[model samples]
Target: MFVDSFSRWMKLYGMRRKSDTLAFVQKFLADMSGTGVPRSFWMDNGGEFVSRDFIAFCDNAGIRRTYTAPGTPQQNGPAESAIWRVNKAGHAARLEAPRLFPKIDFTRVPGFGRDGERLWRESCHWAAGGFNRSPTKANVGRGTCV
Candidate 1:
């Protein structure tokens, strides 16, 4: 949902890391493929989603990419919800370890870069698996989402 190489803000003297665009895209594709690709994908005007390689990949995969107008993120509600969930979960996880503070690098794992990219890929795999196993309020029967 959030397709940026990094989204960390400089709080003081250090940087907040974020997931790389390539890794996120690969995981996103894998996740969607498992559930059946949607008819369309809504995105922002970020360079990450507009990259030549990304656009070509989407085109080849027969996925339609829809971009929201500049400064109009509300138009992408589903994506915004997904991004909010990811960020909220990540932040909640970090908050549980407040004692670590500046000593830890929570954002480092999710952000871009060789190692960070790998971490993000793994996180997606784990997340998808977990979500599939977990029961959803929308589901009426006693079965997993996937």
Candidate 2:
């Protein structure tokens, strides 16, 4: 997940494995078109973020990487704060969805069977979309509804 600090626009990507981060980020940048690559990225020093491929990807794109201090999530600022709200919204959406949608498998609701994790991921994706479209006080005049 990446959030624009000024506008509060968010980009969420669901990955099944750590190795998938680079691809997700690359695709995101490609999809961004005119925005061009970011000057720097703030992220925790997780293995995935520090992986050789990820490092090379950033270097190739001329994106400087900044890592949060170990064991300190607050250093990530807005991105860290937004995560919990995203999760809460997702959980609520998943739980109340049956009531809201009633039928329609509600548009490709995945067959989770016993895989509880995938369900959560799908809900997060759903909520992220809602969040992007829904208006928020912070974004009202700061320039976002993306």
Candidate 3:
């Protein structure tokens, strides 16, 4: 997942391929077409992020690309925190599975709620909402919406 430090907005992904990363950025921009492009895009020193095609795309889009120092995740604390919180939630969800779905046999059914999708979506929303409620300096200069 890629999280915006100031806004606490996140883009979750199932894979981390270079093409997938680029496609995610493109889709996000298309989805928020009129909001204006971000001034810069930050990421870790991952192969997918450093791909030549991705760099070209960002350049063409007029977005500056920034990479965090190797082995220094603290340089991107917001994203790290967001990932931690979501992983913690996932652990809690897994531990609560037996108690919450006692009637369902995991050996056969292997699903939560109506289906697996609902549980995943609910967990994501829960994490994102919690992140959004966290204190941040980004909104201080933006306006009252913070």
Candidate 4:
């Protein structure tokens, strides 16, 4: 997910593999939200962001990378906080799926295991996107962001 520092726009992606970051970011860069390649990326020291393909793409795009100190996520505070908020909302939204839409039995969804992880993931996506677009005290009077 790419959380814009200024707009707090959270791009929640459902990735099946860690390497999917490269593809997702590439697609994101081509989308309307990506007006221009960001000058730098402040990220965690995660293997996904440090993968060879991701590194190569960032190098070619001239996007500088800054990793937070190991074990210290607060270095990237705002993004982390936004992620927490989105996750909390997403979890609640997923739990309320039955109540909100009783007709669909998540456990019985096609192509998903009885655990319903995929179904919950879809709910998370919807909930996060809605939270992203909702009005916020921090964004008052600011122009729209994708």
Candidate 5:
């Protein structure tokens, strides 16, 4: 998943493969609502982002790519923190599902059954709601305007 710092919007992918990353980026660019193509992209030094194909794609799109220093993920702190919060929301949703919807028979959801699909859907809603309702810090002085 990738997070936009200013808008706090996220684009999530089901797969972790490089091809999936490419597809996500393509979709993000095409589907962006308010903002146009970003001036630059900041990411960790992952093979998926550094691959030849990805590099060419970014070059063609005219998007500057900046990578965090190896082993220093803090340089991409906002994205990292967003990832953690998203995952935590998933965990919290899974734990709360049975209690909140006791009659749903979560064990029979099919496919990735046993609450898998339901949990994922619920988690996404919960995370988005939480993010929207949360107050943004008033830090115009520091340029943290989300």
Candidate 6:
């Protein structure tokens, strides 16, 4: 499973840096499919999780998609825990490298634009490479499947 956090920043003049919600989902599925299709997925009811594109992808993949009820994150205990861990790690990384924050150009990220347009293909490439190698607590000593 893949997990990550989405952040939104408000701006006064130009378009706001709205969170890139679909990026995570698309990346997650692509990475998982590289190995094999999963039987199902459990997620929260966030806009990203419930998007039409995500639903269609799951349908085409023959993967069952389950959503937790509103305000009841406990229903998706594992996914919630994974998200919390990722958020904590991201926060720590930011603290360690303060300058890295300014380098992230949201407009350049892939699977992030409207209507399935890809912008940040490079970022997606890097993330996929690293994420597929990172060990996970869920898998214990077993490495992640690419």
Best by lDDT: 2
lDDT by residue for model 6 over 23-59, one digit each (tens)?
5545555654655666777777778767788788789
- Return whichever of 3 and 4 wins on lDDT: 4
Off-target runs (Cα >4 Å) in candidate 4 are 103-106, 111-116, 141-146
Candidate 1: lDDT of 115? 26
> Residues 26-135, candidate 1, lDDT per residue (tens digit)?
66667556556545566788887788887887888788988999999888765565555554544444444435565766555445332233244334444443444555
Q: How close to the true structure is residue 46 of candidate 1, measured as C-alpha lDDT?
A: 83
**Pairs in clash, predicted candidate 5:** none
lDDT of 4 at 96: 68
TM-score of candidate 2 against the unseen true structure: 0.80
Tens digits of per-residue lDDT for model 3 on 1-146? 76766677665555545658788878878866776788887779888779898899999999998889999999888788888887677656655666798896644644454334435655665655565555557655443221
Candidate 3 wrong stretches, greater than 4 Å: 16-19, 110-126, 129-146
Instruction: Rank by lDDT, highest first.
Output: 2, 4, 5, 3, 1, 6
- Sorted by TM-score (best first), the order is 4, 2, 5, 3, 1, 6
Between prediction 2 and prediction 5, the one with superior TM-score is 2
lDDT of 1: 0.53
As for candidate 6, its clashing pairs are 108-120, 109-120, 110-120
**All candidates' TM-scores?**
0.52, 0.80, 0.72, 0.80, 0.79, 0.50
lDDT of 4 at 143: 39
Q: lDDT tens digits, residues 8-73, model 5? A: 666655564665888888887887746688878999989889999899999998899999999998
Q: After superposition, how far is residue 27 of candidate 5 from its true place, in Å?
A: 0.9
TM-score of 1: 0.52
Alpha-carbon local distance difference test for all models: 0.53, 0.77, 0.70, 0.76, 0.74, 0.51
Write model 4 residue lDDT over 1-146, tens digit each, in one string: 67878867777777888767788888878873437778898999999899888899999999999999999999999788877877777667666666778888767768444444456567667766786667767688653443
After superposition, which runs of candidate 6 have C-alpha atoms over 4 Å from their true positions? 1-24, 97-146
Each prediction's number of clashing residue pairs: 4, 0, 0, 0, 0, 3
Which consecutive 10 residues in model 6 have the weakest lDDT in total? Answer: 6-15
Model 3: number of backbone collisions: 0
What tens-digit string does per-residue lDDT give for candidate 2 at 1-146?
88877656788877788878888998889878688778888999999999989999899999999999999999988898778878887877666766676664644655533223447777787777777776667656343344
